[model samples]
Target chain A: MNTDAATAASAERSGSLLNLEAVVVAFGGLQALGGVDLKVWKGDRLALLGPNGAGKTTLFNVIAGDIKPTSGRVIIKGIDCTELPARFRPRLGVARTYQKTRLFRGLTVEDNLYLAQTGRSGRHLALLRSGVDAEFRERARAMAETVWLADVVGVTAGDLSHGQQRQLEIGMALVTGPEFVMLDEPASGLSRGERERLVQLLLSLDADITLLLIEHDMDVALRAAQRVMVMNEGETVASGTPDEIRVDPLVHSIYLGSEAGLGGADP
Target chain B: MSPTGAAPGRVQSRRTLRRLLSARNVVVAAATALALLLPLFGSNFFVEFVMTRTMILGIAAATIVFLAAYGGMVSLAQYLLAGVAGFMVGNAVVAQDAWSKGLKLGWNPWVAVLFALAVTTAVAFVLGALASRTTGIYFLMITLTYAVIGYYVFGSITPLSGFGGITGIDPPGLFEDHPQRMYLALVVLSVLVYVAFRVLAVTPFGLALQGIRDDPVRMASLGFNVSLHRTLAFTLAGFTAGLAGVFNVWWNGQIDPTSISIGPTLDLLIVAVIGGTLSLEGAWLGAFVFVAANNYLRNLPLVDHIGITEARFNTIVGVLVLLIMILSPDGLAGIIDRIRLGLRRLVQLSRGSGAGPAEAAAGSAP
Candidate 1:
């Protein structure tokens, strides 16, 4: 995944603690991101929106420290972490879930959560005589239950059903205790009821935790996010409340298939 | 398949066994213990020639297993890495100017060994970095290329004044030409190497390496620099192979182009794969089978009866590899572990199914 140049740069400076400014990125002649700027305060649930190739996912990549931008700076929680590596950013409390989910197929749910925790890497399997492992296991189980994964503690993340895997992905991101959490298409491949349950889960997620999410399902985004930034042609064309975005002609033109397949996005 | 009872024996036997000692662990421990004591009660000739060779080869194979089983890297260059050590020793004792010519020098054998090890570690790092950039068949191709180039370079290089490969390379004699004394020295080295590897196998590095083999992308997304992990594994494996190389010179009392050639490299692979690439002892077993069989085959009259010759060894090896591949992906270790697990399950059935069962097994099951 390509990270935002601006976000990655700030992450490099203040060690990714969170601020991104006027990030611009392009691929060949296509402007994937154009002077896009956003500020994420702690506990703010921000939603990024746009039609295909609008650079919605590109924004997620930028902030998650996966892809470097053409130019930009990202500061996390007042710390500059523009150049921090993906693993190092996590130590500064940044974590994200992929649109299709990325979990260890061979590792069980417990390990999935365990690996996702943000801290200095240590030997988790080093046989220790101390009782510290008990505390760690308890903490991991509590995190698993928070995402309703306790019943399937031993099930591999790869073997879980689509909805369960999604839940496991969220649980893993949470285990890291990241101050800023970003998710791309978390509602994908979910039944209606599963989507509703996921919405509820997101609403009930811990306070003092910031979230930036991208979803094509309008209903889920409306319910889960406090604000929506509508992207068009690799730029934020409109920013407003959910109700405001619902009736905005520009938002409708891009998302409602009213543009007759605009942006060169083939059906 | 029965949901309750009378399940297919194949499926039933596959049910895992989590005991005080796992089958794999038991096999590893027993193998190490047996090898450790072999020289103790054996005859002097056996101790000097056979056991010494076994320990040296065992160390090499063990290191190979470390890479194959844990790192999931199958390469033909491990012997070449070992060859790095041969020349290191060659520099120390073979050339009159070797010690004088080399960058760092000391007449002390231990320092020479350490110097050899340092060189090997550096080379291993470079090789590992290159190999980690690719995957699957590309890795094999890269390693094979290294083997070919390393062989020719060692044979042709003149700055070292190569004479059909450096000869007269011998570590300072610890026992004044006493074979039994040499055996003791090798036994100590082998035991130390084994313990070091065993400790590392259970470390964070080992787990991450295995994770990469199962799924590289997942490990990478989890913030692991997957390429770095792989390169590190290759480096460690190379270092171990290099250690075996220096020991090889002492075992044979000579170092030559053949020392670094593809012949020994393939032999190392045969030892590793036939023994079973899933466990640490696979290489040891594979080497024993090939070395012992080749020796026995040489004594037979098959050359007269069937026109067999030295060339037949390659075909014979090919046949064994094919059989092992078809019969057990786990190799002999897989078969032995299965049987041991089956016996444990039978005993458990006779009693009652235990509370916590198997901890979700270690192997990747179908």
Candidate 2:
């Protein structure tokens, strides 16, 4: 383990914001997530980098309570939340955006954000008051402004461009005031400008909010996250800062698939 | 600062213009006026039996529309829910005698209706609880199973099953022998049910239910209780179905096993489909079409000459339903929506191509 992993391990001993103790998730004969132990401290920005089928998204799903692990424990804020369904996790300040946009397509952008805002604070089960409450609308307006979608607030979400949809998804995750937000491939289909905007948005997030993101775009991921963990075949291959991981032999070999270019240089 | 941003004043004016140009409000006003004035012009059979029945049936179908359109939980057990309430009214109201068998308990009709509504609402809550955990076809199957169970349970009851089910269910003395008075009460009830549906649609609960329908996992992650919202939606639908059930018994002065059977279940489903599953107005239209077609189809000269009998009415209705489903999957409302959109586009196209710049600007301002 690198120094960062060592520190994260010690932080887990002291009850980190999120802890996965040898969590294993198997789908039939295929083990999507091998027994993996991980820790995310409060206010930490973690970028999970991996090739396809590396189980980063699976790990995310387990943490988000979408999938229960085959064995081991998932502790959120010092409480074991392995048994709680995904819906209950949100009340505990866990939020996530999907790889594919999972927005309410029929609803306007403002309405979608308003729903998220109200879900966090308003009486969501209220039958008399409209869902588009004044406070919620205000918050939605502010969030739309933050995501640069203010002008299109009335547009249905399905009608937005792909990049705008991704921005709106991120805005939705952020609007809930979640202590822990897990974003799955937020920069997957973005143009350069949209990716820069997303990186800026991620970087400018409140320090009190912990973020765990899965991204294939190494540039955006490295810039936005404080710590990076590279996984291969459902196991952690490397863990360190962006600068350390940039030159790591394992990372270089994993990405480039050849050790010949390195020529066995001493670190 | 947006590239596509139009002025707020321009948007508002365009919205107002669209509203003024739209024929929706005019149609609604005319329909409401015609409905309210129906009793003043029509015969007792037309006024009380046909129109009132249509409205009551519309209320029942509206429940399905609420679930299918908003919550995305299509159910076949809603008519069964109505039957439950109808049976409750029968069990509570009809005086205990040789005709009552073991069913009647001698309660007043008003009390019976209230008790039936409450019980059916509770049953709805139970069904909602069970059905909320499922979605799409599984949800439909669960409700269908429940409906089948209800049908057989009522069918097996010796006292209630005679000549299909219970009879001699009389309404209160206030409207005694006055079909017009009964019709008036039904009109009020139907209107109240529809208004309640409208009120619920714009509420937080309804919106949350819609969110759940569109994407359950997303709604769950956003902190909305998906199952709870679904259950609540089902319960609301059940309340409307229950009211229709009570009114149905009062109208026919009896309850029958056939009323809750698959035949009527399909009838309700057809009503929702034909009118438009997404709109209450569609439900009313479907009901009107179903009732009017059933009433008038056999009276045609072609039918009389070809020896078409009353028993073949369902066959004709079935063919009509199949034709409508093939032509417009979204039903009558969807057809109307398509026509409106096409007309608007044509108007815009004509203005953009031939009219002056000012006309084009006005048309596209919104």
Candidate 3:
């Protein structure tokens, strides 16, 4: 039964970029995720939708190698990285932004983006400034422009407005040029205009990069993502294209009381 | 477009020019120049002894500041590392007097200095490796434990440290003959160290260290090996502390266990805190304050009237430190920054009345 479920979940395994086989995570007696199986194909835009405490962020953490699943294999780019630490994720072309927006508050936006780039490629022990540093600086500037933070590139992350900080969080995640990007609620605190811009930015990303976004805003999530997966009580309740997930009765029932409508409504 | 009708490039250049001529920069430049020419005005006792002592202590305190401010590792083992270098210098170099019993390998002073630095750096790397895995209070405690262990080792090892410590150590001939030249060399070294740290603060590694300081978990997720970065910072601080140690042994003409004890360790930390743990320049300012207070504060008529002489010197320093902390938690550097900001505001206010609001807003944008 378990093998059948695993095969069923990862049926399209030929072009799969990320595969989670029987991933289970438990915090003592409470099970955060119970035997979850998932497969993300290359260039896939998958939106993970779930209510509060539904194990969406936990799955992202496990995939990002921040938290090792209690019992399961996390295969990314055909490599088994279940036991690998978070620092090794960059080598596998994986980047993730935290739900709480973890940023180096004391550093400027440019420095934050530059550090994200350098952490993946540049030597951490190079004491002397070099020509390569100039290239990284230029790339950081380009990323700032990409995130619509060009005007405030020199401002410290801590001093930025909440919307701007969220934008910068996305910028840092994308600066490393990872093949797979996971954004946990990138529009959590953004204004309506900023949210629209963020959706546009998400749509404008390279088609070759796989994106897994966790968002509560049905409007932003449905508009940006091609595929949608719904999780409830640490289990996959439903998975389908954006349109199918919107019309599904189970999704409506799960989200109706809390979110009111599955249609593009601002929740 | 700027209201001043200047090109963006020209505006940037103008801002840079303004920064170059800012009040703080002018004051710093003037002070550096004065320090370089201090020997001409001051008595030999003041210039040679007090000034040189301040520079040595300043270098030591700078290591603590570098580790704490940039790396966020408040290490108390900096002085112990310096003491290691001093011990190496004493053991490796030839003693001037026959009464001193040590290895006395009679190596060249410069060579011995290099050797001492190498040893100190190795020890620092080892200590960093041990303590980098821990953070906050645990890191402080582990480093403090190392300092205590070092003190005991130095005190117990009579063969190398000698009963009273390896004394009769002689400086190179150039410094030994000319006190002013020695002081000037120290000044030059201090400037170099200061500039080196400033340049380092903007480098990729330096920025990464600061990132780790601000958020180690975020840094780790970004693929930075947080522990390795912390360890490397500790090793670099060790090298700097070693530099201070070599100079200190030369200046004092000896190496003793008392120098690395818990008391002196705390004293170095106090110096760093008083100078401003966030600024490198605070190291010297703090050291100068500490050295001056230690030397002259007890001689005041007020102290005599209070019936507290040199025996209560620490009490006087404690009160001063308490006052400074109450006034400015960031230390002297914080006070200086506030004063500079106040002066800039005053200047802006005067200019605002003449130029109107638009230009004032642009000027105060930063």
Off by over 4 Å in 2: A1-15, A130-132, A256-267, B1-26, B159-164, B353-366
Candidate 3 per-residue lDDT, tens place, A178-227, comes to: 88999999999999999999999999999999999999988899888999
Give the DockQ (C-alpha) for candidate 2: 0.45
How well does candidate 3 score on lDDT at residue A1? 43
Using lDDT as the yardstick, the better of models 2 and 3 is 3
Q: Between the candidate structures 1 and 3, which one is better when assessed by TM-score? A: 3
The whole-model lDDT of each prediction reads: 0.71, 0.83, 0.87
Q: Score candidate 1 by lDDT.
A: 0.71
Query: Which runs of model 3 end up more than 4 angstroms from their true locations?
Result: A1-13, A263-267, B1-23, B95-97, B350-366
lDDT of 2 at B196: 75
List DockQ for all candidates. 0.21, 0.45, 0.50
Q: Write the per-residue lDDT of candidate 1 for residues A1-267, one digit (tens) a residue.
A: 235555545544544235679998888788899988887666778788878888988887777767778888876655555676565566556778888777767667766665554133544334332354445456667888888787777677788888888888777777767777888888898888888888898888887778888988777887788888888888889988877777678777767656433322221
Candidate 1, B149: how far from true, in Å? 4.0
lDDT of 2 by residue, A1-267 (tens): 265456545655684889899999899999988889998988999999888999998998899888999998998876678988887777668889999899988777877887886665547888766435866777887999999998788777888898889989998998888889999999988998888888889989998899999988877888888899989888888999877876788888775366653332222
Say which docking band candidate 1 falls in.
Answer: incorrect
In angstroms, the error of model 1 at B259 is 1.6
Error of 1 at B106 (Å): 7.5
Q: TM-scores of the models, in the given order?
A: 0.78, 0.90, 0.92
Could you give the DockQ of candidate 1? 0.21
Best by TM-score: 3
Q: How accurate is candidate 3 locally (lDDT)?
A: 0.87
Candidate 3 docking DockQ: 0.50
